[model samples]
Target: MTNEKRLPPLLKLALELGPLALFFVANAYADRFGFAEGQRIFFATALFIGATLVALAVSYALLRKLPIMPLVSGVVVVVFGGLTLFLQDETFIKLKPTIVNTMFGAILLGGLYFRKPLLEIVLDSVFDLTEEGWRKLTLRWALFFFTLAALNEIVWRTQSTDFWVSFKVFGIMPLTIAFALAQTPLLLRHEAKKAEEA
Candidate 1:
């Protein structure tokens, strides 16, 4: 609520998604670029790392500050991605989502344990809600994050590299969007009235 203008939703989505899209594309065509069968993921990880940094830079350039969630995610991407490239291990990159989601889940739940709703801060305080509403919403998001972390673990452990990449791009994004849209009713129901305007 600092009166700073947020990025347009579509633009924000693009910035958030552009790296993933590029990662997918890079992985899909790594063979055409002559990377070995086992090296495709590594190649894609390099691109993903670069794209994430670029996206963060763009966000900072536009807003003069980075969003908390993306900045945290980007840091993990770079770290895990670097490990993947330097060590020639796909496990690090594959585990990145699981680690990130679990961290977010724990953070949210920990906040609630202390009677704080950290989601509001993470979301830049965009939504004004009653305390109960905030608690409920934060709890829902925490569980959702845990679910995503579990899903990522299952997929990455059991699926092929290509399949895991596809799921990360296709599966997770749609699920998140659906979940968010499904919260509209809760948000509307709990919206705080501007008593000061009376």
Candidate 2:
């Protein structure tokens, strides 16, 4: 995949994480900005929607294409975040993560069921792996996504909006990064080597 386009690491991080940071900050300061007691989540939802759209546009400009995962996640955020703001209910925004994570998990598992190894399609630029490696890695990611979905369900249903907002940015992000980094050995062990040029 020498020809695959790659975003520089820091730019990629900003494109992905900047929207979440804005969401967290907007929610935290909504009160100071004169939003009512129960309306701060709506304020955050609106910002999240806008920020996600901006991020996607920036990504498209830089890469000439949107990455699969973020593109899917951005669509879900816009839809659910719109519902949250429109219905004046925070439940929809809170459910966004559970829905997105579960959808990803199901898609990965479904791909494996058909022996497709779809993660390769999304990650080929980052890693070159054997078929077995792709299968193992996809299964692990599928399980991890399901775990994240369950965790989101538990936290949002049981915790306050402020707590959920904090957890989304501070807790879930860290867990995701840690889990992805932990896959380094598997990625290294199964990396595919290219033939030498004649």
Candidate 3:
């Protein structure tokens, strides 16, 4: 049970991004299968949920159960996914990520009220940080998600549907990757304890 090498952070990010990419790609092609924009969005979301299930299956096969953060995302996906199907509207599906991210941000930030860094519960398996380090990191992430939600609302509301779709695939995805990449230096700077623990 001793593999000295650790999985890189980018691999974890890929696990999360893979399903989103699948969603975008499927949405781009759904019309060929007779789906209109709304139906395309619904199917795209369903496809994302399906991808999440597949990821969960693979995660369980490799690590058992689900990763904490992804588990929360999966739950929201199912909840919103149900609404998308029942109501037969794609907007609900489009808003799913925003809802999940907003909730996550609020919950993480709210934990500070109790002087706890609850984010550590989800992230501890991947990274180690001192208590203060965790608190600051958590705060930043909370704000980041909140801002992302706001941005999502603005883009999807004001832009043309084609523009919004392009934003999802090009704008948001790139921004997220850039943001994640920017975090690596911070992670490395805080890697002292994690390195020891590892």
Candidate 4:
């Protein structure tokens, strides 16, 4: 196996966020670039698929392995994006976020049902926590993912395509970041408690 340096946090964030940024940009300017209304969604979906593949390739190059969440998400993007293009239906792409988020939420909650706090698997490298802390954090994240799924459904059903794209790009990201930051205190407390016990 080849040894590879772990990606820096900023570079990791860029790899994850860059594809969504490209999708949003492509959609926003599709019309000015002379794509018809019907063609804009297809154009954006194609761009999104390409960007997601590039992101995955970059992640593997840096980390020497694909991250689970992004691998799952990239698969969904490519499949749904391809359906959107093949069927010429924008709804497939619109529904992708809802499906992906719901799947994640279900998996997390299901892990709890099986007496496993699976968030630890994803986050253990970055955090030290008691079992109770892991359980609480996992529950919080599961609920958050469900909330995001519901929000995506509501936005796509009620809002314009452009509005939904903006919400996906701007709203969901900030909310996730804020939620993660808000958990810092709890994480620190758990770490301290673990240290004390040690």
TM-score for each of the candidates: 0.95, 0.95, 0.82, 0.94
RMSD in Å for model 1: 1.8
What tens-digit string does per-residue lDDT give for candidate 4 at 1-198? 123356888999889999999999999899998999768878989999999999999999877799789999999999999999999999999999999999999999999999899998887777878888888899999999999999999999999888998999999999999999999988987784566687
lDDT of 3 at 77: 78
Error in Å for residue 169 of model 3: 3.2
| Residue pairs in clash, model 2 | none
- C-alpha lDDT (0 to 100) for residue 30 of candidate 3: 93
If the candidates were sorted by their lDDT against the true structure, best first, what order would they fall in? 2, 1, 4, 3
Residue pairs clashing, model 4: none
The Cα local distance difference test for each model comes to 0.92, 0.92, 0.77, 0.90
Question: Which pairs clash inside model 1?
Answer: none
After superposition, the stretches of candidate 2 with alpha carbons farther than 4 Å from their true spots are: 194-198
Judged by lDDT relative to the true structure, which candidate is superior, 2 or 4? 2
Q: After superposition, how far is residue 88 of candidate 2 from its true place, in Å?
A: 0.3
Per-residue lDDT tens digits of candidate 1, residues 118-194?
A: 99776635888777788999999999999999999999999999999999999999999999999998887777674
TM-score between model 4 and native: 0.94
Clashes of each: 0, 0, 0, 0
Error of 4 at 28 (Å): 0.4
Off by over 4 Å in 1: 194-198
